[model samples]
Target: MTTPRPAAPSPTDALPGGLGRRFSWRGRQIAWTAFGDGPPLVFCHGTPWSSWLWAPYARALSAQFTVHLWDMPGYGASSMLPEHDVDLGVQGEAFAALLAHWGDGWGEAPHVVAHDYGGAVSLRAALLHDARYASLCLVDVVALRPWGSPFFRLVRDHAPVFGRLPPAVHRGALEAYVGTASHRGLRDDELEALVVPWLGDAGQAAFYRQIAQADERYTAELEPLLGDLDVPTRVLWGEQDTWIPADRAGRLSAALGHAEARLIPDAGHLIQLDAPVALATELRGWLAEVGAGRR
Candidate 1:
């Protein structure tokens, strides 16, 4: 069962301006891109999502800071072979490696903006891998315990069975699963951008492979170490997040050493799309602190 290496996609193949480059991490070519010249800022996305999640924000903030984004090895526009390890612990190490790979790009500890499971990865990178950040903003992140929707639990227990589903059936399930993330339904094109990575033979298998590999122990291990981090932090959640209830926001902020937790109204788990304007305002305000500190 050899998985042939697929051709790499054009850097700007999907998201406008895209994460237009690659970084080799543990033998996997991770897709990434960066822009601007102000203080550096990096974005880390969560499960079932990719660098596209930050494309628009990257473009808007590029005018103020060098914004960097990348797709995890088993995620969008990156390697998705069945054998690739795409779990949280590995992802954290990869993120740490990705940052180090950039060398002087992080001469100054960069600001980090993370969403969902990306939060866990960034935290691990900092706690275990010695990755430093000027500041951290966690948006509807996956950090607390007892996560995983019923579907996630089902798939986690039987990923191989689900991975073997007919392509059409898998597509429908993916669409429906993703739909739950937004309070307002996503546009067809929007949904396509998020779902496209999990289509076809390789993508479908990779999709379930990631779900199967998802384990909360990665975050649990870092929980007690939360307050040990001295980095400035902000926590945000969509008021209507059905996937990870909004109630977890305050606890997470508290665990992060009295950090602020603000909930955005009318948005669900996918705050970037559900409430872009508000999310942007919050992010800009949060990042502004970093700018002020250096001045």
Candidate 2:
């Protein structure tokens, strides 16, 4: 029997990363959370993941910066209806629109931290849509050309077929695929938290929808102009990131005008789970630079 889905989280409920509020953009509700009292720092997550990926770091950094996190329109606690355009193109616009929604903080430029495909979306917002930022941190991000794993390609080509799989089959594929992102392997709880969002029909269909819409052209449009980005940038990678391969970090750094490609040891693509402390130390340091009015 298909399990009846749980009630959608209300604003009063304790949620993952404590993201209990919503921001409506383009008729879609975007779930978000914020804390601390310093300059604004926004985090953007990539595919099959949500703001929960950054929850630990958000709290760790909360002491010094007002850390903000939100699920994209079709991810996390946000809307995932069939009518919503959750592709990178629309994601970019939604991101820029969210920034506008937070325009009261404009006196201080927000620092944007993006992971995976989020790198492309944030770049599109900053470069094309004219969203400003104090700095940017691209961590295990999908920005350069030739991205998308073979599995990603498979799903992109056959999303409808895969989406129709029996629940057991889809869950199996989801576990196997998402597990590969972290070299150290996830604890039972971590794995469950990540997997639970894509369990039911809405989540399952949205999962395939995003994969089918994953296109290299999104980053392609921003590559030539990477050097023109005026904000300070930091490119970070996991030493053992087999998914994107650590080598791509160097190329991305060079493309961003020689920003150093900092690698965290004993981690993979999902550094947030594999090496939280190391990543946090790096962020605290870099964000310290960003916070000190060092442009």
Alpha carbon lDDT of each predicted model: 0.87, 0.85
Q: What lDDT does candidate 1 reach at residue 160?
A: 90
Cα-lDDT of candidate 2: 0.85
- Please give the lDDT score at residue 263 for candidate 2: 90
How would you encode candidate 1's per-residue C-alpha lDDT over 145-195 as one tens digit per residue?
Answer: 989899999999999999999999999999999999999888776787788
Name the 10 consecutive residues with the lowest summed lDDT in model 2: 8-17
Estimate TM-scores for all models: 0.93, 0.92
The reply for model 1, stretches above 4 Å from the true place, is 1-17, 292-295
Which regions of candidate 2 fall more than 4 Å away from where they truly are? 1-17, 292-295
Error of model 2, residue 46, in angstroms: 0.8
TM-score, prediction 1: 0.93
Predicted candidate 2 versus true structure: per-residue lDDT over 1-295, tens digit per residue:
9866445433213334467788887789998888876778898999888887887777776776787888898887899987888989999999998898886755877998999978898999999999999899999998888888889899999999999999989999998999999989987667777877787999899999999888888888989989989898999999999879889999998888947789999999999999998998888888776663222
lDDT of 1 at 183: 96
Best by TM-score: 1
